[model samples]
Target chain A: MRGAAQSLKYLLLAAALAYPLMPFRDVYVLHVLVLIMVYMVLAMGLNILPGFCGLLDLGFVGFYGIGAYTAGLLTIHYNMSFWLIVPLAVLNGALFGVLLGAPTLRLVGDYFAIVTFGFSELVVLFLTNEIWLTRGPLGIPGIAPISLDVTWLATLLGVDERWRYAFRGEVPYYYLAMVMVALVFLVMTRVEDSRLGRAWLAIREDPMAAASCGVNLFAYKVIAFAVSTGIGALAGAFLARWTLFISPDMFKFWESFLVLCMVVLGGLGNIRGALVGSAILIALGEVLRVALPKLGLPAETRFLAYGLIMVVIMRFRPHGLFTQVAESTMQSSLIKDLRARIAARRTA
Target chain B: MLEQQLVNGFTLGLIYALIAVGYTMVYGVIELINFAHGEIYMLGAFLTLSFISMGLPLPLAVLLAMLAAAAIGVLLDIIAYRPLREAPRLAALITAIGMSIFLQNLAMIIWGSRPMPFPKQALPAFFSEPALTFSDVTISWMQIIIYAVALLLMVGLNLIITRTRVGTAMRALAQNQTAASLMGINVNRVISFTFALGSAMGAMAGIMVSMYYNTMYPTMGYLAGVKAFAAAVLGGIGSVPGAMLGGVVLGIAETLGAGYVSSPYRDGVAYAVMILVIIFRPSGLLGRAVTEKA
Candidate 1:
């Protein structure tokens, strides 16, 4: 039954991916979907650290900015290929994650959040003031887009570029993003099911007991930070490619907060919940941006509305819409079933 | 030249210490960081500016601003915090962040995003003028007023905490919440009073900051709040004198860093100091190490 359910889930995901390629799709809808995927990727990365590890990182965007800038500079200035620069960006982000997490992970609770907040602001300030590299506020422009010569592959398959328009336009990127998201989801699922994920939960629930049980709290936390930040950098690279422009404005403290909201709203540490959360938030932002102008609402009033919505959400659903429960017991039940199956096989 | 930097750093440090006191006191008592306190500081500036714009005298305006800020602080506790007293710490933390964002956006809606120029003419002519100068170092009368006001406020706070019965109750609550409650102390009232006191101090800091900079913007409190938070942590989050010490140290570090190193790196220097302090001395300079009860 479990195997069948898992297969059904994957099948549904595949169907959803293929649906975007269908004709008659509105360009604006495609655009919103692409953005939703982007945020989903970013929020998932953040979830590993803050949601799974229970580290309140108010400056998660620092890693995102680092990744975006890394890809932007390498491609724009050094004229490196997009494929070549992506890995470097992720590595750069992970390196900084280690640098930040190494010293600060020792501090727990609100102190950790404060340090991360400072780190995020420092990154923005650096990007703003250091005109020599970042070009300050003017920002980097004309970033090359990702292009692939799939005409030969198409010819082999007897398909024309016109039919491939969907792929070239938004469909391919959507699938690519989906693939990355799926891969992250798988890795996170495996990690969360493993002893390491349990260690994180143990630390989150009761650090003292976890410590008594021989969990190396600092080591696991740094690992989670490095992994999450590395993935955030990957998302940044994708964002640079998608927007085809890189600027300090793209990565700010508010961006981090938005990702946090997505995680909290969806249900921390729950992948499906995060996807739903990102979709809802990005949709709300887009709708507000478009609808408010038509409704004759002042531009600033939208921000006020956004703030009020956040306060309301926080006030009512502090645990988020989807509560993250301990999954270990469920895993144990599955393990017991598997063991029983093996014993029955031996008896038969 | 270094002396000027030192003086400037000390002045900035005092202002940070003033704000840090509220953070440390609240954290010491309830373990909540009160993220909205920074917004209260911003409100203090806005309230002061509003009162002065309404043709109130400068001193009277300042007093009114402080009182308004204190009242808001008390109101915040009553509305947002008091109900969440028994909830998880993370819940309260989220609410505080939410409140901070709400207050900031509210301010933006009420006052335009553009900065407002603080009226220098509202003060006495002599107070508005530069009072002292040395070779390449000019000290304004306003700076003197800021220093005097901040020092007096800190001293008064110290006296209130040490000598007064209310101060004794506050200390008792900080040490142990349940015990304090059992002793018939109105824990809710004490907490509200803490917020009010802290808000008043933050308001004073905001006013002095506007005078020092000669302008105020909606987002000014964000950075100042972060710096003040760093100061509070550096002094040990729950220690008053420690906050003062941390603020001065951070201020000096920031100013001297801008003077000697690149000005662009001043903020980095301050944060670096905070990171180093947290890494090496997690308890802060004056803070007592707390062990979690099982």
Candidate 2:
């Protein structure tokens, strides 16, 4: 029965993947799908930090901006290869994550949040004002698109001449983005069940108790930060290659809030939640962007609707749509265990 | 020129300080960043415009704006914040951000996105005229009135906080919610009252800046709100006086940076200073160091 159910799930997944590439698929819809994939990559990264680790970071877009800018600069100035810039961007993100997280990890709760906010604001401000480096507010234009560099392999495999040239079309890029998204999604699921993830959840549940039980709180927290930022950086780099222009304005703190909203709205600490969350939010954005103008509503209504959605969701479902079960169990266990332990200690 | 910039900075900083106080106080009690506070300030400004345009006296308009904002603050807590008080702090934070976005876009819808010039003629002539003229630094009566009103309110707040029974209860609640409740303090009432007071101050700051600058807009709250929150953190998250000092410091720093370095970099300077302060002195200027209880 379990085998049959698992195969059923795989069949559904296969159908979902195949539907997008059907011959009748619209290019605009395809574009939206790719964008959703990009956001899924980002939200998956964020799933590790605030979802599992319980550290609320408001500066996520800062790391994203850094990755995009690094890619843009290297492509613009040094003419670096896309493959090379991807690793470089990831390493840069990890370095910056450590640099930022090392000192601020000790801050508890809201202060940590504010500091992260300040850091994002500072990054955007610097990016906007430093004309010499970032070209200031005008934004960097004519960014190079990614090349597959797979032509040699195709020719070696003796494919037909028509099928063996350099890659082209948004369709290929969509698959490329999907591959990365799948890789990130796989890594996130694995991490959620890994010992490192357990360590993170342990620190989140009770720092002092976790510490007494031999959890290296700062070390694990910092690692979460680095890994999370690295994933975001990877998304940003890939996204920059897809788009031909990059700008300081594109990386506003609002992007961070948007992704964070997805993580929470989907379900904090759930891997599957990240995928569901990003899809709904990104689709909502795309629909509103297209629909509001048709309905003669103001462009600003798009954002107003976003705000209303959040309020309504929080009012109706504070634990988030995807978090109905595990949330209660997790909370009850932690609080109940603590209270029980204290009671037993007093009785003893 | 330097003196003039300093004056400008103080005026800006005082307004930010008022908003910061709202952030600091609410944070002290509930530990949510209260992202909606800036929007409260924006509402206060817009409410003042509505009331004054309806032929109410300026003083009455300001008072009504404050009261309405205070009520809104209370409502915000009761609706968005109160239920999530015992839930994870992250839930509260997200709700606050949501509320802020809702309020901002609501403002934009209610009032068009364009900048509206405040009706300077509705004020007495004295308010429009110069209060005192110095070399290249003439201070207007409006500036003086703003300063005087802010000072008066701050002093009044200090007295209420330090001397009144309500203030004592508030401080106790801030220290320990359960302990204060155990001691017979009504935690709910204290939290509600704190929100009312903080939001009142923020509304007044919004009104004053609107009149002082002679312009208002829905989006004004975004940057001002961010700066004010930064001020609160820079001064120390939960410290009231620290909000004031942080506000003034940020104001002067931005003004001077704009005057000397580059005009566009003013906002950057404030954030840079904020990050440095958070990095170097997480305790803030006057705040006591926080130790993790867990």
Candidate 3:
């Protein structure tokens, strides 16, 4: 059964990879898939907090807005390459993360949540009021699409034509978003097995006990905040480039709540659950958007459904669809090898 | 001009205090943020509108609406929050947010998404007229009514908390739930009463604001709730008197900040104050220090 389940997973992944190239591919469907990927990255980023560190961060979208506006402003003002803008945006996000986290991390659970919320609202206020920088309520438009400038290689080969390939269609963005999701997933799974991840888990389980065990709780939490917000910014950078227009409304508090909902619905502390949660909720939102109008209700009322899903899930499945956290660490080859060696020794 | 701002700020401050008291009292007893409290306030306005349209007098409509708001609050505690009492705090908080969204959207679907004017026909003819004029400052009759109603409800609330048996039980529960229950305080009943009282005060605030502004919408609660929660935090969570003082201070600051500083960043003032208070003085001005429990 396990072998079959593993095969099914790989088969689905293969199909997903090939779907965009298929003759029957729909533009609308491709757009939704890409949108889902953006949220997937966000869910993984947010999973680091409530899932791993047991800190409920309510202002995660603040970092997302920061990253997006950074990318948008840079592209419009300097016409910088996406490659250069990405690192800059991520660093900017991490900087803000540390700045906000250092002073506020000392607060416990509920207090910490409220402060994060206040910070996000302030972010929105800044975005809306700073007309000189963010373009205020009108939003920044005409951000250049990401392009591959491989002209350097062509010049080395003495080619006549330029080798620039600017993204013009959804197909290129679809693949790029998939690559982004994969990279984020890889980093999350790897970190979950690292010492840093374990330190976070210890902090979440018991701060006092973890402190007695010599773990620097404050330092680890700040690190988690930096990493999490950095990833959130990365996703935001992708969003700005993909949509080609960035607005303050796009990063409202509701967006943070929606992403948090995705993380919780998938199960806190479960990385794969985050991916599943994003896919499910985003797909559900699309369906509601289309079906609500047919049912004589406005599409915005879809939040009502999202809210119901959260309450029902919290009541019936609080741990989410999956229960085991750090499940990847136990399945590592090294751990499996140790198990085998121990069994062999006992048998001898 | 400063005096005018002060008078306007004072009226706004009184409403915030009424709402802030609800947040503080609930937090004191249950340690939950009760995000849906703002939705209750919105519902109060809508319910009053509905009652008034049904041919009920203005006073009767307001009274019925507050009662309904109180019942909804009790039901909210029973249905959504009661089961999560022993669960993790994160779960309860998420559920509270979910309920808030659900209630807000439900109100939208019922009332339509447009802003509705509070029935002007139901209001007294003189509410829009100025009642007092001193130098350059003017106080409207609506402002006077708001002051009177807010003061009355707050005083009534204070009497309940200080002089009643249930009030003592609530304080006992806030200090230590297990001990209070051990003393046969009927923990859940006091909690329900607390929710009922707070929701009624919040309802009155909503009603007055809708009357004052002559408009209300489904999303109005989101901003008000955040500002009031900020007020609650500024007063120090779990402290009623502290919440009142914090609300007044925040309202005056916000009004004066809007008047003198950038009007575009008026809403930002509450958020900035909340974050600063939480970071620098987590205990707030009137509350005890908050330390993480083992």
Q: Give the clashing residue pairs of candidate 1, or none.
A: none
Q: Give DockQ for candidates 1 onward, in order.
A: 0.42, 0.62, 0.75
Docking quality level of the chain pair in candidate 3: medium
Query: What lDDT score belongs to each candidate, Candidate 1 first?
Result: 0.81, 0.84, 0.92
Mind giving the per-residue lDDT tens digits that candidate 2 earns over B1-294? 989999988988888898999999998888778999999999999999999889998889989999999999999999989988877777788788888888987887787778997777777878879889987898988888878888888889889989999999988988999999999999999999999999999999998888888899988888899899889878988899999999988888889999999998788876777777877897788887876655
Per-prediction TM-score: 0.89, 0.92, 0.97
Candidate 1 vs candidate 2: which has greater TM-score? 2
Worst 10 residues of 3 chain B by lDDT: B285-294
**Model 2 lDDT tens row, A175-271:** 8888998898778767766678778888877888888999999999999999988988998898788876888888897899888888877777876
The CAPRI class of candidate 1 is acceptable
For DockQ, the strongest prediction is: 3
Chain B TM-scores across candidates: 0.97, 0.97, 0.99
